[model samples]
Target: MRKKHEAPLDTLNSYLPVGAYHTVMQYLGHYKVHLTITKERRSVLGDYRFAVHGKNHRISVNGNLNAFAFLITLLHELAHLIAFEKYGNRIASHGKEWKLVYGEILQQFLLLDLFPPDIANEIKTTMRSPAAGSCAEDGLIRVLRKYDRKGDVKKLVEEIDVNGLFRTDDGRIFKRGDQLRKRIRCLEIKTGKIYLFSPVYEVTPVSHP
Candidate 1:
């Protein structure tokens, strides 16, 4: 969970999409936020922490994400900061107030034509009813995955046929099962235990004789 402090725009450009440098930096500057580029975390893409007694607002985004994903994740966290600033702790997280703020912020960015057509369309649809997580929109997540850096081939759990095997990042093998609502049932090879996994969980497919 190492966090790298803000770097020069030249250095930061490596992690952001083209034409997004100034806008992203401006938000960080205006809010006096302590922006951190962090190592990947399984549970969340990015997060925000409001300012306390003597500290500035803090925001962190996973550094390993693609440039587009990086920018989107940053904006998502920025929206959280803005919502908190306006409403304190009165509103529920991802409630109406937060959704409105998030949609507004995302719409502003959309006007800049920062994203590709497919991604933009999916994002627009997502804004109508923003979800708690940035990748909550299945269509958006599927489109975003196309921009991911190529290497270490992997596929979403939903892409694998039932009974097919896949290996997670931790090297555990699982046998894919039926789809149950949004999650897919999977059986662990070693433990023979069943687990429910998000359809979007990326895993390497396994070939068995």
Candidate 2:
């Protein structure tokens, strides 16, 4: 009998890269995971919640991600689940144990050659010591962005030239300023307020006269 939490293989296929359905399904079925593909979230790419009190392990990934990003995010969350099962909340969430588990699981997919050359290389480098968040790996995120839908017009904040004008999705305009460490400073046009933005923040470019 099919577990109530298990998604049908065909339905799950749409959310994953080609050739990934069977392997991913095996994990989900074995663990009885409840996976949800959610709309884009500003704060997280995916999240994991371990089973408790009759509830099954739950994982959620952003629906807006490209196939490669989606797969990586799913694995990220799955690692959290696996680590929790192994260590039973006795270790840090993103500590050595979690990183080791994440790396090993990620390596399995890497062997499949499911990603483009550049993306695969970046993933290999990142797997050595996986970060708490997939987006924290700038090189990996940059490479993954190439696979985003072609119709998407948004550009990363880092892609904007210094002093270039850009508009956030919320309709606010800003002038891209210098980078202060990892974050970029952008001056808001409306209130003249400056804000630090993630390098990967997506905004539309505003052409100047």
Which has the greatest TM-score? 1
Residue range with the least summed lDDT across 10 consecutive positions in model 2: 1-10
Candidate 2 residue runs with Cα over 4 Å from true position: 1-8, 207-209
- Candidate 1 residue-wise lDDT, 135-180, digit = tens: 6788888899999988848899999999999998778999999999
* Steric clashes per prediction: 0, 0
Error of 2 at 209 (Å): 13
Candidate 1: lDDT over CA atoms?
0.86
Model 2 Cα lDDT, one tens digit per residue, 1-209 = 21123345568788788888888988888888988877746667888887989999999888788888999999988988888888887789999989999999889998877778898899889988787885568888888899999988889999999999999866889999999999999999989898999898878999961
Would you list the C-alpha lDDT of every candidate in the order shown?
0.86, 0.85
TM-scores of all models? 0.91, 0.89
- Best-performing candidate as measured by lDDT: 1
TM-score of 1: 0.91
Clashing pairs in 1: none
Evaluated at residue 205, the lDDT of candidate 1 is: 96
